[model samples]
Target: MLCVGLDPDQQKFPLSLQGQANAIFTFCRYIVDATADLVCAFKPQIAYFASARAEDQLEKLISYIHRHYPHIPVILDAKRGDIGSTASQYAIEAFERYQADAVTVNPYMGFDSMEPYLSYAGKGVIVLCRTSNPGGSDIQFLPTTDGSGEVMSVYERVAKSAATKWNTNGQMCLVVGATFPEEIAKVREIVGDMPLLIPGIGAQGGDVQATVKAGRNKNLMINSSRAILYASQGEDFAEAARKEALKTRDAINRAR
Candidate 1:
């Protein structure tokens, strides 16, 4: 259930890789090689590469994972959202240019903006439902009535829409933060058996046992980024990442 997130911040890099050429790709590939057998998926946050002007490195890293660890899916955490015309181009960027097995998207724009991505057969499209950030409640927690006159929060509406209406091709999943176990259980109840990408465990201090109990009986990709990535700032970063990932995996299993 543990999904190792590759958010390679150069400032946090080990001494050996700090000034190397192509360090982003090299660092991420090493992490992938070290933890591929320990994780169910790899989530690469796009802003980390884009801010560092290493988009090409991100592409190479994903390609390396595809060529070597093809069994593990790559979820590009772009959270892309746009109009239909522009969303089509963004789809090309994610599915064609990056060749990501799955991509995280913002569902605020509704189904039309996401249709182009869902058009790609066999590719997973994960929508942001209840985000991990504290500010998510500002919008996600607002009460709104559904078509049936039932009151629910925005996140609940998103979960309902993704499960019953928007998931025309069965390629949809929801994002519910690990911080809110009650909300996670509510989402699980709304969307039966659908996969959920649960972020906010390690650096964000979300509990593993509550998350497991809330998200039980469904597919959950519990992601841990900084805690695993910077497990040690030494030459053994990859091994350290693997160890942290293994420890995290064991914790989630024990919770299960």
Candidate 2:
């Protein structure tokens, strides 16, 4: 599945929409309209809207997508994780407040931190595993000993635990970066058929073909952010985005 990330940056938007109050929403709307047919889902990164203090616009954008393209799910890339009570609020924010179909969450605080999200049986709770950032290796690659006296990378452990223990609701998914196809393969092997949300493919320079080869199981959501959203700085931005998105979707299909 192709998941387009609607992470709008004021500095990167087309010149005409840069100073508008609904610039982010407008840009996102065009992108969604252009690629809705080709994508299985849309991911709106919370930080982009929150940073600009445009939560209202974010809500409108999500509502617009739902109202127009009801079939494509929206995964809010919030990466929220906290204690039970706090996690509950975050869960409400992602699933209730924003009405997101799925949310990206951090698992650093362990299972208890994720229980609140897990309680929402109908909503997807995607746990962060091997992230796409450069500093992801600082923690994700560390070796840890499981209770069975077996050693594995922290990400591998998270994958195992998420797949076995925390997936009772069958709504759990893992976020494995496309930048690490080998790790994607490893996580896919550990988790079997569980869905994986793979990012880092576009502007992050992740190899789409390799990512597909390693993570493809017809259960992966390959996301592209800046590459599709900011495909052009001109008025034809939406068309440019569609071209890029179509290319990406076709590439993933071919790789599969």
Candidate 3:
């Protein structure tokens, strides 16, 4: 699926909408109007809105999108990871408070931490495996001896663990960043048919072609955030964003 990420930064808003929550809402509205037909889903990274103290407003925007655009699934990118009780609260906030179709989460805290969210079979839980950040390799690529005495990467182990042990709920998917095509391909093999939510294609300098060829599955949802959302700061920004998204979508389809 073509997933467009709406990770808005207020500082980059158009001059006419500078420093306003309404501006962010208006920008998102225009983008939804522009690219709705081209995308299967819209991902709003919770951290972006939360950082601006617009978490409540963000929820309202998400709710409005759901009510008006029921055809488009909304994925809340929160990367939430905690124990059962706290995770229950998070699940409520994601599935009830905001009424999101899915959410991105960190699996570093283990299975029980993700259980409360995964319990909802109709909803989705995307567990972070290999991130796009440059510093990610410090921990994720660490070497460890496997049953065969062959060295295995930390990310490989994480992908295998999630696909085999934790995917019992069947709501499990993985967040494999686009920056590492080889790692993504490996994860794709381990997960088999499970959906993978891929991010970091645009501003992160990830190779879109390689990412599409490597990480994709029939269930995959490739994402592009800042590259499209912040494509322009003029009146035609929405149209520019739409063009960029369409290019990415068509490119992905071509690669597939």
What is model 1's C-alpha RMSD?
0.9
lDDT of each: 0.94, 0.93, 0.86
TM-score each candidate: 0.98, 0.98, 0.95
Worst 10 residues of 2 by lDDT: 209-218
Name model 1 segments beyond 4 Å from true: none
Whichever of 1 and 3 has more TM-score, that candidate is 1
Off by over 4 Å in 2: none
Per-residue CA lDDT of candidate 2, range 125-203, in tens?
9999999999999999999985899999999999999988988889999999999999999999999999999999999
**Which candidate comes out best when scored by lDDT?**
1
lDDT of 2: 0.93
Worst 10 residues of 3 by lDDT: 19-28
Ranking by lDDT: 1, 2, 3
With candidate 2 superimposed using the best TM-score fit, by how many Å does residue 112's alpha carbon deviate from the native?
Answer: 1.2
Positional deviation of 220 in candidate 2, in angstroms? Answer: 0.5
lDDT of 1: 0.94
Ranked by lDDT, the better of candidates 1 and 2 is: 1
